[model samples]
Target: MNFKHLSTSVIGLLVLSACQQPVVHIYHEGLSDTQRFQLKQQLEQQQINYEFTELATPDKYNTPHLLYFPGDVTEAYIQNVERIVKGLGFDRFDSQVFSHTGHYYTKGNLGLYFPSAYSERVLPELLFAHNCGDQDFQIHIKTNGQWTAMNSPIDLKGLDLKWEFYETFFKLRRYFDDGTFQQQVYQIKQHQVRTLQGYKPAVTYEVLGHRDYSFSLFNCDLQAIFAD
Candidate 1:
């Protein structure tokens, strides 16, 4: 598409459409209000900026969310990509291109993505279990036109765990410090990936702690999460 040749104004519109931020809804379901408030206080204390909203009202709190939104991009990896996007002469609008650092929810490693384009990348299935002993998270990659599981995640005592998916030319897997695993697989053609019926990703603080959670299925071809 010769993205480099895109004009500044066109790029601005792209950035806007690609990186819209949404209100961070804090739900107190199943947990006491006190606990919810406590967690809320902690999040506020951590100084992580998020739109504070009550779950009771979905419409008033809803907003278009794009991966380019300030909070949406992992603080650990947004800077470099931001610089690149800026260098592209885009003044930050709807459609912006980014590269994954192959690292998720952790510092140093940055996962790149295009804010405006519908991506073929699918995050890994996140499973959560409280059995505190030893466990491993496994990831499978389609390489050489075959599917195979790479190294399992190192077991550790913690409530939250994660897995991530990204598009890459190579066939390989990756592990992160925050218990999240990642891998690159063959890119699916635009026709092959199905549209999700209803999908939304959110972050919340409960008695357990802060969590970045999401749910979606591309017509049952992929089932994924980032917790436990």
Candidate 2:
């Protein structure tokens, strides 16, 4: 088979089709009236463009608790990938594709993701945006009866996040940056997009604790929070 002769769109379509995961439900238990109202208002006003996704509990059954501006990631990365797909006229995460400067929360380093997994390359430039600390999304959470906006959240201070939020550590351990890695992982597996179960958090306070960084929310039964 001449993969070299295949079209980029065809390759992209193949990868998209091969993706099979159940959809999870986004819960409202974490959001208060104010947060919900503010979120909706922001979307209507176009004041911000972001992706929001929360996971459910039990480590067996996962759900997406919420989502907003779903794929509205910084357009830089999207444009870069789209450009290459156009030039090569092929669209496989495989082969020799170069990802240009893109953005997650903002424009930073670009990366290349090869289908072979082994050939996936992460140049120094791609790690630039993640070499620093976290400045969480402009979202709010209610803890102790107060609605606080998480513009630049503090680690180990999980605040109002439920158990499922903690599980993200292990579920998508592929990358761990300030908080970008976990957040991106959650967004990709959004409940509104697919139906899947719990993958669990494997990060702890030792050994690979460097990744755990400032998050200390896994100390309790995240699922039990909903149970009680």
Candidate 3:
């Protein structure tokens, strides 16, 4: 074993590892001055390379408070970044992973929309819009007090609802063709909807003559249950 050759190989591996670490570019759009300062300070303390950048335009989705990573990034890097952000009272949602952006690269950089404020203090609200293709349904909401029947969209304000720092807990009922209803409980970010268990299992369904029917079920919508 040549000592020089061994040393060179170790150095090359170290360089490659360093290069693989993503450089975080935090977009400070809705963040306050103090929040921005604290975020940078925390990143520096963690020895993570990061820089502040202006908010990019054409964000048609209107999601200015999410952390966007490269589609091809390793899950480990994603978890590390999430842990760091969580320390600063930032909560992430699953939908945020698919944020659209024009900043694509071979070696992707991590981008964050660090908002100054979060909506955790606000009361949670539920909106049940019937979209099961005219299928009549019954809804129930579990609260700290008791299980209440929810006919229309009801505000959980001044009501005892099961909620956590970043998620709201509730149960959904799915009507089956066999004259049976199955209860499915879910804990999701506020303002997000979860399909009733086993709803829309496929992307599309073939119709006899009209066209391919897209599978979509907008059962309900919860609002103001997440941290910004």
Candidate 4:
């Protein structure tokens, strides 16, 4: 979905919803397997200068730490991030957003995208169609201490992922009349999940909303906190 055009409006809404919290922007794109390997090398090599350890396995730093994330996220990618986060004794919190090629379930204030003038509810239904088989999602937390994001009481150590988007098809399938039909049906494939291996974690930060969603770290520096 060409959210680029709606970016401004969407961000404005999200900002309004969480006026008291900071915003930590994370940007990333999918990479091929070969590219991912190359990126990993680059990140590991730069860790020294960045004063951060690569979130890698084999105890690269010989530190005893745990990396936590939602099981819904691919294990390979999660492990990749875990390695680096654990290496720094950093806690990982993930609220897996369901995004497909055409549609996505990001922050609700960001709204949803669809081809036709479908109802707002259609957004979640299509975005999570793939996960419907499992009917769940999770909030993963990996922390050395029992610290939790305020107002978010589902202890981070571990919890079963569960989120079932309401399922009710539209009155009429609008594909016949909509050019965006194809995009609407698009989804992020399993292979796309593997591509995340190449991404790097940024500094620790917090993104506050009505409920604090602790993605605090992602593709960019999370250390930069800006309270609204």
Best by lDDT: 3
Looking at model 3, residue 190 earns an lDDT score of 20
The top-ranked prediction according to TM-score is 3
Off by over 4 Å in 2: 1-26, 47-228
TM-score of 1: 0.19
Full-model lDDT, candidate 4: 0.26
> Candidate 1: global Cα-lDDT?
0.31
Q: Give the candidates in order of lDDT, highest first.
A: 3, 1, 2, 4
Error of 4 at 197 (Å): 27
lDDT for residue 129 in candidate 4, whole number 0-100: 13
TM-score per candidate, in order? 0.19, 0.16, 0.41, 0.16
Which scores higher on TM-score, 1 or 4?
1
lDDT of 2 by residue, 1-228 (tens): 767667876987887744421121222223333333544454435433333334222221122211112343345534543343222212222212222332122222122221111111100111101212343222233335332334334332433332222422323232234543432122111111111332211111111233343342211111101110
Show model 1 residue runs off by greater than 4 Å: 1-23, 56-71, 75-228
Worst 10 residues of 3 by lDDT: 199-208
For model 3, the stretches where C-alpha displacement exceeds 4 angstroms are 56-72, 91-106, 115-227
